[model samples]
Target: MEAVLYAQERSKETRATLNSLRENGNIPAILYGKNVSNVPISVEKLDFKKQFNEIGKNGIFTIDVDGKRQQAIVRNYEVDPITREIIHIDFLAVNSLSVITADVRIVLVNDAEGVKDGGVLQQSMFDLSVTTNVNRFPDAIEVDVTHLQVGETITVGKIRQQYPFEINHENDEVIASILPPRQEEEISTGEEQEPGIPENLEGREE
Candidate 1:
């Protein structure tokens, strides 16, 4: 999906200017491209929010700058710890002719057979890193764990057949595992020993 984002060229790169831009509700960002030149830009907070919310991070979108359009991906961003608002963003313009490496959301779906048998389900990886063409990148990778059993593990090699992209990890790498239910053991106490008193040794010396 593509999002319509409008950006402006940053006139200055000083802290004071950045602060004033923030006061005006604009965010500082940079756009890096392999084919296009890297440039510093600023975008309105409300405009960015509207596009971000619709396409989401990691989704390929088009950024329109001065009537020029560039296909890019939201590489990274910084958020305020307290306000949870986006502060800065970094974008990378993708070349449709080359393959790019990216992480795709990995979701474990369906009830595991081992879970009903008192087994605990554990996911080792939350995202699957893969290399694929820009237009071929998937939104997310879903894995079915309905056949997973206790003490059994699902490896990357097992689900490779379900995807077209090349996974950038070892085949034997573990993805998810089902652990047996934890056992409860009763605590056993040893016989208590009598406390030694200092006066007891003095009586023997007398």
Candidate 2:
């Protein structure tokens, strides 16, 4: 999806100036790419968040700087660790034929068969790095896990076979997997104790 964001050229980039812009509900950003010179600008915080929600990080959009419009994509952003508020943004100008590298979110579709059988479903990778034409970029990649069974896994190679884009990962990289169900162990005292993997598996991020 494509969106248009309105911004105004920023004349001052001092710390105080940037803080002032943020205080005024604007985010300071820079737009640059290839042959384009870096242009410092500011956009309304609410407007940027709205458009960003519509078009994900990989989605191409247009940035209207004053009266000039340029096709661009969100390259990166900085957020305040304390407030979790976006502080700065980096916009990369691009054309239709431009090839870009981006991280596309991985979405698991449907309930896995193993999960239905009391097995634990674990997603190892939440996103994937890909290089593709700007026009062919995807917001997210959906992996069907409906048929995944216990001890079975979906790998990067399997995903690559379904998508035409170039994935910047090894073919053997595991995306998602189903582990055997938790087993209960009988202690010497004849009490049932939880065993096997913990309910909250290690290395799994929320």
Writing each residue's lDDT as its tens digit, candidate 1 over 1-206 gives: 45778888886899999888878999999999787788898888998888777765567778888888888888899998998888888988986685788888888999999999999999999988998887888777899999999999999999998888899888899999999998989787886767786665766854
Tell me the TM-score of model 1: 0.85
lDDT of 1 at 200: 52
Candidate 2 regions with alpha-carbon error over 4 angstroms: 188-206
- Per-residue C-alpha lDDT of model 2 across residues 1-206, encoded as one tens digit per residue: 45989999998878999999999999999999999999999999999998888877777778998889999988999999999999999999999889988888999999999999999999999999999999998878999999999999999998797998999999999999999999988658666667876766867888
Candidate 2: the clashing residue pairs are none
Worst 10 residues of 1 by lDDT: 197-206
CA-lDDT, candidates in order: 0.86, 0.92
What's the lDDT for candidate 2? 0.92
Residue pairs with backbone overlap in model 1: none
Measured by TM-score, the strongest candidate is: 2
